[model samples]
Each structure stands twice: as structure tokens, then as C-alpha cells.
Target chain A: MRSVSQKATPDASRRSETARRAILTAALDLVGRVGYAKLTIEGIATAAGVGKQTIYRWWPSKGSILFDAFLSLTTDQQDGALPDTGDLAADLKLVLRATVDELQDPGFDLPMRALHTEIVHDPVLAADYATRLDEPMRELKRDRLRAAQRAGQMSEDVDLDVAVDLLFGPILNRWVQRTGPLTHEYVDLVVDTALRGLKP
Target chain B: MRSVSQKATPDASRRSETARRAILTAALDLVGRVGYAKLTIEGIATAAGVGKQTIYRWWPSKGSILFDAFLSLTTDQQDGALPDTGDLAADLKLVLRATVDELQDPGFDLPMRALHTEIVHDPVLAADYATRLDEPMRELKRDRLRAAQRAGQMSEDVDLDVAVDLLFGPILNRWVQRTGPLTHEYVDLVVDTALRGLKP
Candidate 1:
């Protein structure tokens, strides 16, 4: 709790904000270590060096804590925001390149993969995973594809939804299956090759 | 072990075949009930009415036993066949549709999902899973894509490797991520859209 006297000073509020960040970081580190099934409020509090009551006061569940912790780490505050450089191909390439880097990180991949495994059987987790992660993932691609279309780089009838799904579907699939080397070259090739129809 | 005399007889071999099927079926059922981590050779032997030594003699590891059991269930024992309809689209569609059916089945999905999750972190398991499963998978897609190219359905300069990857990447992505509803309609859309370039 912020001291009433400290709250009166802007500097103490900033210090409190730093404490909140440390707590979130600690929660994320703990989730990465123990995984979803074992992640508990007390464990998070201990990791965060905050009271269990503090976490409960802010969030309802362990899943929420981990999800929010992860969300903050990505630094992507808005789901719909993608770069609008007016060059659609370059923009898509830029976003995908960032995704490639994000996916390659152990911090993001390990916990996300753990979360994904549970989501397979748990509908509540599945719905949240879809809404919070999967759909936003789709929207990321959809926005890029829409941008491409608006720039006249992609066909008008390409069906932005389907286009996004198809484009992302393969990339997502490759990542999930670990089927191939997911490098910048691979993403660029898939994007380019898909643009040029298979039939000449 | 087969006796020298019984080994010479077709009927005795038939009986051995029957027991092997029984063991494999039991293995599948048991693995479904208790996950791979909990599954045991003794349990498989008991369920199949075979001696523990019989399973041990036949399979060196539980992973091998479960692997064989799963392979038996998913495979139809076709004679090294890749679909060869003269029409490339039809041929590829037929193959993909069959895969869609296989992937959609709970019998296949459960154990496959379980094994898939396990292999994500274990490099040895990942290699084993890839060799045992992905080789045939790669072969099936490669053959189909090549057939299309040879038939002039695909671009002449189309990179066979990339095309093959594209054909199944989206489906595999959906399957692993549980991101989207994978259906024949979706498959058709993927195949069609992928075949025709996205450009206007």
C-alpha cells in the first residue's frame, strides 16, 4: 500500500510504480520456472515480494497474473497497432520479422507453449487463449494483409480474414509443430511465394 | 518365441499376429487412460494377456511400445503409396482430406497431441517423432506437389520444397495451435487459395 504521505509526493508514486513492475517481473519468472498448473498466488507474491492479498486485490487468478505479466513483457499495449509505413510488403515483412524474434525468445515461447498445451483440453483457457492471444495474432496478420490490400499490393477480393488466416496459419503451424527452421528467410519466402500464385 | 515347427506353419504365425494386434490395441487403450508418462510395459502386457517379458522382448522401451501402438492405429498399411490421380488438385485434395479426417479423430488427436506436447522440449523425442512421423508426412506432401508441377498445375519454377511446406503448413498450424476450425471447407480454401497466387 502506498503511504498517504508518500502518495502526496510524485517521486514516491514513481517508486511504487517501480515496485509494481518488479512484482510483475517476479511473477513471470516464477511462471516460467513452475509452469501453469503449479503457479499459485502465494508463490507469485513471494516471488514478487508483495503480499498475497496485494495480488488478490489486483487480479482474480493465477492465469490472469501470468497472462498480464506476459502481456507487459511484450510491450505491445494495443493489439491492433501495426506499423503503417504505406509500403505494405515492407510493413508485413517488418511485423513478421519482429514476430520471428519474439517467438525465438525462451521467455515467451516456453510459458506460451505450456499455456497452449493446457488450452488444448481446457475450454475456458482455450477461449481466453483464443481471444487474448490467438485472435489478436490473427488480427496482427489481418491488419497487415488489409494494409497490403488497401495499398493495392494484394487483391481486393483476397478476403482479408481468409488471407490473414491462410498466411498466419502456415507460420503458426510451423511454429507449433516445430516442423522446419523458422528463420527470417523462411518467413520472407513464404510471404513472397504465396503472393505469386503457385500456378504461373 | 516361435517354435521351429510352429514358425513353419501359417496358422501359428496367424495366431502370433493376433496377439501382436491385441497388445497394440491394449497399449493404445491404456495410453489413452493413463498418459505416456504413466503408461507401463507391464500394464500393456497384462491388458493384452501377454507376459511382461513378451513386451520387453518385442520392444526395448515404453516409448518404442507407445510409438508402435500409435503408428499402428494411425496408419492404414498402404503400400508406400502417394496419391497419383492424374489431376494434381484432386490428388492433393484427396490426400489432404484423408489427413483432415485422421487429424480430426479423437483416437488420433489425443495421443498425437500428448506425444506432440512431450516432444516440444525433449530433443530426443522430437527427433524420434520427426523421423517416425514427419518423414512419411514430408513424402506425402512432396509427391503431391511434385505431381502437380509435373502436370503443369503448379508453376514450373515453383520451389518444390517451399510448395510442399505451404501445402500443409496452414493445416498443421491449425492442428497444433487449436487456433481455427479445420474442416474440408477450410482445407479446400487453403488448397485453392494457395494454388492461385494472392496477387490480383
Candidate 2:
């Protein structure tokens, strides 16, 4: 989608882009410091050195701003594919281990966890989250699994949705619920254990 | 733990128990009606026909009240064991399907989801959640899996924790994220796939 500023003068468009970036950056920084419950639009505006009206014109609420801020970071970091080294287990472990590291990073963890907390309570935000972030990422996972199925590394009869959930669900559940430690060894075991059933 | 009321007269103890029940009931009812965000001590007191001091004397916060209320409901419903029909897959499917239904039930859903939303943000509450609710439930699940191991229905080498997560995680992830329909069929497939593996 083209920006509304596309029809505006070059100088005006550049300024708009600058303000947008600043607001997103400020939202992430402030959320990390103050926590999501205490984060306010006035605080973000003051931190960003922009008018509160500027933020209001673009995003309706702090939740929306945080969504965009976290989404921007994710989009910047991802190259749009789960790594595929032709070994399905190795590829999954590689990606999931990276995820563990990212979630552990203080900079990323607070904002992402904040976004998840918001997603749990708000249905509209959850829909936006599913459409924009989750589905695309899930598709990338499915692509890798599809490749594995074709390579005869996985059963062709396996349902990709269920398989995808099986592959990623334990790690995700732990993160969301804080049920267990997120670790490289944990991801490796999760991958190995999922690929090989409990049945003897 | 014995109630403090155990030291009091039987009439006084009975009165205290009645008030305690009222507060828990009111907490769940109010949360379901107005949501956790808007639930307040004043509101709960009015609904329960008790003074605000009554609620304060017992539970320190709304979160605690909701926790007790939810815990009571769960304990009453559970029989202290996952069914051991001596069929691992069928037993797991039976319990998980019941879980799926409980999550879908209107009376149970709102307060439970409210507790989860709080747990996501509050480390203290998360700890309480893990110790008081999750660990005991997980022990029951592990017991069933251990029975499976002994029966030769499962591999003895499998990590019980990881095995437990594998069987329950997909359904839980789906429910928490609203990522898919929570159907008995979905739970059945998750059990089968996790037990059978994707390896052909």
C-alpha cells in the first residue's frame, strides 16, 4: 500500500517518514522501560520529541503503535524464510534456537511479550496479529516442512497445520506461559522428540 | 493448609466459610460480566452482599480472588487422575478433549482467560499459577505417561516432561492463540500425531 504522503511534496514526505520512525522507536524503548501497563501516549510523544497529535493521526492506540514497532523489528531481522539445510530437524532446531536467543534478549523480549499480552486480551489486535505476523511466519514454516515432505524426510500424509503446531507449539507455549526455560538444548530436544514419537 | 477459622467457634467458622464462598462466587460472576479490567472490590462487595472490608480481609487483590474461584471450580470437576483406560492415545485424547470443551465453556472460559492474561504480565502471579495450579496438573499428566511407560505403550527413554508437552502443547497453543478451531477431532489428531510421529 502506498503511503498517503506519496502525493505530498518530497520535503513533507521525508519529514513524515522521519516522524514515523521516531514514534516506532520511542514506543519500543518506552515499553521496555516503563512496562506496557504504565506506557502512555504522552510519554511516547515526549520521548520521541513529537506532538501527541502526530501519533494519534497515525495509530489509534498504544497497542497499535507497539504492534507496528515490534513488527518493524521482526520484519527487519527476518529474510522471509526458515533456513532449510535439507535436514528438517537441523533446520527447525537452527531457527527455533535463534528464536530462544531473541526471546531472551532484553531488548526484544519485553516488547514481544508485551505484544503477546495485548494479543491475548484484545480480539481485534489478535486478528491483526494473525493476519500480518503469524500467518506469514507460519507459511514460511510450512514451506520448509513441505520441502521435507517432498524429500521423503517427513511422512507425506502428515497434516502441515498439525505438524507445524507440533514443531513449534511447545516452545511457544513455554514462552507465553513462562512455563519453562527457553534454551538451545530445549529446542533441540523438542525438535528431536517431535520428529520421533514417544512410542517404543 | 487448615483455615484460620478452625480456631474459632463452629458458628463463627461456618459464617466465615459462607462469606468466603460468596466472595469467590461474586468474583467469578463479576469478572465474567464486566471483565477482569473493570472488576473492582467495590463492585464485588455490592454483588456478594458483603462489605469491601470483607474481601480485603481475605484476598489481597482481585487476582487472588479469581485464582481461588477458578481453583475451586477446577478441583471440584477433576477426579485427581487422568483416566487410565490402559490405552495411552485414548486416555490422552479423552482428557485433552475435556480440556478443549472446558476452554470453550462460557462460565469457565472468561475467568480462566482472565487469569492467563494476568499471568502473562505478572511474574508473581505466574509463579503462584505454576506452583498452585500448573505443577499439580502436570504431575497428574506425568503419572499417566509413567503408566504408559510401564505398560510398554510408550518408550521408557522419552523425557516425561517433553512427552507431556508434545501431547498437550499443540492443543494449548491453538487455544491460547485462537490459532484454530478447538474441536475434539483436533485434540484427537494432536494425540495421534504426537504419539505416532511424522517419521514414515
Candidate 3:
């Protein structure tokens, strides 16, 4: 029950952040090497050289620990913003190209994939991941497309929800299913096809 | 080395088929329960009520067993197919509506999700899965769209790949990510949006 007010005592605050970071790093490392099921709080604590209570005080479960770890790894654990450089197509292309880069990074593959697999199997983890990770990305994508629409780039009647999916879904399908090589060319293909209406 | 000879009796052929079905079923049940990593050849043997020698004499690894299981599951799995009753939008709607039904079916979810997530991390498994499952579904969708294209119902310039993704991507995005409710209404939204192409 010790909230931020109690933690704001400088000594507590400093120790908490340090332990939190250590715990996250350990969790990420463990999942990367051994996968999600094997990565436990005790294992993470031993690997992090922190007490198990330290991790439990912050996170309730191993899945929770992983949720934080993925968040921090992706964007410093904040509600990260997507790029908004003013051109709808350019901005979309840029964001997707960066996403392709992230997916391709060797350091990210294992743990991210582990998290993905876990989400598929465990409903609790899937719900938590969706609420915390997936929805934000979706909203971010939607907001960007809405911005484009307001700027007169997209059609007024464009279904924002499906449009967001059209932009990002193929990339996701590729990543989750490993259906194809996720090259820059592939990302461009998605962006181009999504935009300009994919019709003659 | 055990290629069936013309002189070989029907009994041997029936036995081989029976073994094949047992291995496939065992793989599905085991992978569904324990996961891909822990699913060993010995484990499959025990689960299938066969000897380890019987398994090794046939398939090579757990991956191949699961691969065969998934193939059979997909082929006999369910009836979520694109309807070709001649109306493109209606056909698409019917197909997607069935997919929504499948995603909602508790029996269909866990195993399919299990295999999907497992393959995300396993390259060999992923490649085999893509070949067996993802590729075929994609091609089916593409062929449907192509037929629509020829019938003057769809845009010829629309990349069938992109169009298919647009058609099914949101539904899948919801299913895989668990972002939102995947209802008949949601399917209708995507079907309408994708067909319209957002051009004023």
C-alpha cells in the first residue's frame, strides 16, 4: 500500500527506480534467453541481484513484470507518441519504416515473440497486454490518420478504425505469423496499398 | 526405406494412415496443453500411446508432428471460408462473419492461438506453418478478390494481397491483439470501408 507519496522520500524514490530498472532488465534478459514460461520473479531477482520482495512490491506476477519490461524497452515506459511530421503518407511511411526496423532488430525478436506467444495462450496476459500495449498503439495510429483526414489528405468518409488497421495490420500479420520477410519494401507496399485506395 | 510395395497388403496402408492420424492428434493435444517447447518425441509417443521408436521411425521431430497436426486441423478444422455466392461484398461479408464466429468459438481459439504464437518464435515451425496455413488462406483470399476484379466488382489496380489484408486484417487485428469486440457489426464496418477505397 506504499504509494508514491511514501516513495517520494528521496531515499525511497531512488531505491525504487533503481530496483525497478534492474528488475525490468532482468526480466527482459530472462525471457530473451529462456522464454516467458521459464522466466520467473525469483529467477529475475536472482539474476538482477535484487530481493524477490522488491519485484513483488512493484509487480504482482511474472506477466506483469514482462509488461513493464516490454513497455520500457519499446518507449521508456510512457504513453509514447507517434511521429506527426504533417504529411500523412510521409508520416505513415516513416512510422511504419521505423516499426519495421524495430521488428527486425535481433535484440527484440526473442522476448517480443515470447510476449506475443504468451498473450495468445493466456487470457489474463492477453487482456492486460491489450489494455496496456495494443490499444495505445491503435489509438496512436488512429489519431495520426485522423490528423491526416482533417488536413484534407484522407477522405472525409474514411472509416478511421479500419483505416488504422489497413495501415498496420499487414505488418502485424507478417510479424505474428512470420508469413513473409518484413523488409522496407514490404512496409512500403503496405503503406502504398493502404493509401491511394488500392484501386485504379 | 519402408516405401509401400504393390505386394504390400491393404492392412499396412490402413495402419500407416492410422499412425499418421494418431501422431497428428497427439501433437495437437500435447501442444495445446504443454506448449511447443516441452512437446518432445518421447512425450508425443506417450501421449499418443505409441512407442518412441514408432514415432522416430516416421516423423523426425516435434516440429514436424505439430506441423502435420496443424495441417490436418486446418483441412478438417473448421468451415471459415470465403463464400462465392457471386456477390463480392456479400461473399466477403459472409466469409468475415464466419471468421468472427470462429474466433468466438472457444474450441477453435486456444489451439490455433497456441500454434500461431509458437511459430512466431520458431523459424522452422513458422516457415512450415506459413506454408501450410497462412499462405493458403492468403491465396484463397487473393483468388476471391481476383475473381471479383475480373467480374468488375473490385478495383483492378488494388493489389489482391493488400485488398485481402484490408478485408480480413481488422478482424484479425482484433482477434490476435484482443483490442476490441469483434462482432458482426465490426465486420460490416471493415467490409464497407475497404470496398469504398476512401477516395472522394
Best by TM-score: 1
Report the CAPRI category for model 3.
acceptable
Error of 2 at A90 (Å): 1.5
lDDT by residue for model 1 over B1-200, one digit each (tens)? Answer: 46867767888678788888888888777776676667888898999999998778678987887778767765664345567877666666877787788888877777676676666555577677767777676776677666667777777776665677677777776677666787888777777777785222
Error of 2 at A113 (Å): 2.4
The DockQ values of the predictions, listed in order, are 0.48, 0.46, 0.49
Question: How many clashes does each candidate structure show, in the order listed?
Answer: 2, 0, 0
When summed lDDT is taken over every stretch of 10 residues in candidate 2 chain B, the lowest stretch is B1-10
Q: What's the candidate order when arranged by decreasing DockQ? A: 3, 1, 2
Sliding window of 10 residues with minimal summed lDDT for model 3 chain A: A74-83
Ten residues in sequence with the least summed lDDT for candidate 2 chain A: A1-10
Q: Which stretch of 10 consecutive residues in model 1 chain A shows the poorest summed lDDT?
A: A191-200
Which has the higher TM-score value, candidate number 2 or candidate number 3?
Answer: 2
What is candidate 2's lDDT per residue for B7-96, written digit by digit as tens? 667988788899999988889888877777788989999999999998999989887788788888877787788889898888888899
lDDT of 3 by residue, B147-166 (tens): 78778787677767667766
| Interface RMSD (one decimal) of model 3 | 2.3
Tens digits of per-residue lDDT for model 2, A3-111: 7556667988799999999999999988877777788999999999999999999999997898788778877877777888888888888889988898888788877
Query: Candidate 3: what's its TM-score on chain B?
Result: 0.82
Candidate 1 per-residue lDDT over residues A48-113, each given as its tens digit = 787888778778988887677767765553345777877665666776767777777887777766
